[model samples]
Target chain A: MIKIYILSIFLFTGFFVNSQNLKPEIKYLQIINNQNNKFIINDNIRNAEICADSLFYRIDTYNNDVSSFFLLLSESYYLLKKYDLALFTLLQQRILFYSDSINIYSKKLLNQCLNKTNKKLPASFSILEKSLDTILFVNSAQKVDFLFSITFFINSKNTKHKLLNLITFYEKYFNQNVSFGMAKWKLLNTAGINLKTQTKYLLINDFNNPLSDYDNQDLLYNLPIKLKNKILNHNT
Target chain B: MFFIGLLLFFASEMFSQDVDFYIKNQNDNFDFQKMPKEMSFDEYNILSQSFRMQDMMFGFFVPGYVHFKANDKKTGYALVTLSSLSYATFAYQLVWSKNNLSDSSFFYNLNNLSSLSSDLKTNTLIMGGALFTIGSSYLFDIIHGKYRLQKKQNAIRYKYSLKASLSDAYIPNKYSNIACFFSMKIYF
Candidate 1:
């Protein structure tokens, strides 16, 4: 009876160990990570594409440790200049990891990519990042707050964008100097103008209209004035 | 449609003789105005026959008695009529209600069907309300069935765990099992 009991114990222990030792059956995470790390350090587009392709192929079945894997995959795809795929992967990560604390890193990666591309960012990213930046920088130091506030206003839905631009314009004058935000707002307005001229069609609801409940006209007038001054400077 | 066709067939047969006689008399130059206004036997038979047809087509579907253990069709018919009468009375009370103004038009339109001017509207509201109640009961039954099935499934997945007590005894407790068996499926 004792021998039989010992045998049963041995069998159970062996089964538990075997189950625990079983690696992820479809082990693509490590392979993708190794390739992405190499690309990150060396900026190798070819290796990044190979790994991104493999990662994309298994996206449907991926459930464990999703946050880091998709972040790396998104950066890797962006390195390969696959902007559309990078955008799609980042959006998927947002959908899956929206409530996760580590989503900050994903948002940062998205912002980095958007900054590198010099055109109108996707409306979805603009709206999402605006909310994210506001939450993240709402209680930071004044300098960081000012920087983030400017970024948030510029990236906010067009109406809020105009309001923030106005607030920041007067803010710079009162603080006694021009700032990077003043330049960035000029860039945003130029892009908005270029978009209007290039495309005959406009969304019936242009997202850039000023807020409906603005109690301050002085703040409202400042944004267009700054943008107009920037355009005049450029022509002269 | 078949019943109406059958009714018209019988009606034509009963009326054919009187109609033929009237036409024949008129063609023979006889003055028919002096005749009595009363209908002939054949004409009366045809006229009375139609009332029977109307009763057969309309009233047969209305339940005469409530049988608890009767067939489904009979039970459904009984429930519909009883529920319809209750709803109609409730609707009438609501429309004529002096305490509240809300849903006044709704109740007024429904109750106004008894007034010949709104017969169509009254019948529609009653029939619609009856069917709605029947459908709600059927859907509730289906949802209840699913809930019972889920309970049975959970019962099948329960397991008992043994816990050691301070008195050197063990107690058995039941819990729902959490582990799921994974399978990968591919369709060609």
Candidate 2:
């Protein structure tokens, strides 16, 4: 009986070891990390792309670690000035990691990639707007930041009307019984700035105006004065 | 001893690579998906149907049943409150009759008819019936709401394939007729 027990234990140990070996190995992780470091820290785009591609080709698409590997591959493509390929790879990653912070990062990177390719700014603004709308109920600060970023890209007359409507929505929200949290204030200020910038751009027709030209002067100096006075009167 | 400990560690590490652990750890990462805001079509249909059934059954007797179905909360509350007050009045009259019955003087007087006046007895019966009807309707609404919520969740996760087809059907003694059919294939 003792001999049989000993034999069974040996068999179990051997099977366990074999099973461990059968599991897909992340042996490429260290190599991918090294390549990423070389690209990010040393700024050697060509060598990093070669190394990343070689390592990435060894990885199967169905592998559990494929997303991470693809992220590195996309980063390499971005460093290599291959914006289109980078955008495509990030989009693929977004499909796999839907509604993840990694997807958000991919979107930010996509915006940058599109900007580099000289695609229309409205398309990028639309992406931000969609993300903003998605996270509106969950994260107010992120929603405000998205609105702030959108203000930079609103150039045409039609988009300006849309922005005006958005500003009014925020203004009404702030004026209502809703708690005036930091995010609300930030959103209001962003709307004011957007209005001022749009007015300046429309009146001057100069997109290249320097920031120093408007120093110490409120761009929304005239628009919000009445609202501010009303608020002050209510407080007093 | 060191070798055994190392073996145990390796075994645990290998065990931790199981699919459950992988999924649990993956879900721990931050997710940015939006919460669903609007009622689905199935949910809307269920609510509206529940409202219609209540209207058909009790709209005349129950004043705010239709309003409640239409999502007028204030009117619904007012009707429910009135029903409750009527039920309370019936209870109070029953208690008053019980006290009168226990009073020997009133029982022997032969002037009062069975300790409760005929008008009060009739009013109590009407109130009781109205209360039962309104209460059952409210209870049905609650149960239907719960059932619809569960069905909505299931519908969100359920996968379905819908196929619609149109074909020509031959008639024995007349022109060919057009036939249309819808096929729904659902996977749970």
Error of 1 at A181 (Å): 31
Candidate 1 per-residue C-alpha lDDT over B1-188 given as tens digits, one digit per residue, 9 for 90 to 100: 99999779766755544422233434533533221122244322232221123222222244321121112245445555665675566566454443443333544556565653454464446555755664554443334433433433332222001001211222222231222222333446
lDDT of each: 0.41, 0.43
How would the docking of model 2 be graded?
incorrect
Clashes of 2: 0
User: Best-fitting candidate, measured by lDDT?
Assistant: 2
Q: Which stretch of 10 consecutive residues in model 2 chain A shows the poorest summed lDDT?
A: A21-30
Q: Per-residue CA lDDT of candidate 1, range A1-236, in tens? A: 99999899878867654433112211233343455543232222333333333333332333444545556657666666655455545654554323355676777876776666443554554675666534333322222223333334233232234334434544543443223334344444544545332122222122333333332232224345665455556644
- Candidates in order: C-alpha RMSD to true structure: 29.1, 26.1
What's candidate 1's i-RMS value? 27.5
Q: Fill in the DockQ of model 1.
A: 0.00
The Cα error of candidate 1 at residue B150, in Å, is: 55
lDDT of 2 by residue, A1-236 (tens): 99999899879867654433212222332243355543232222333333333332322233334555456556666766766556545543443223453556666777887777664544544564466434425343234334434343433332333343434544454343222222233333444544454344332212223232341123324435655454344434
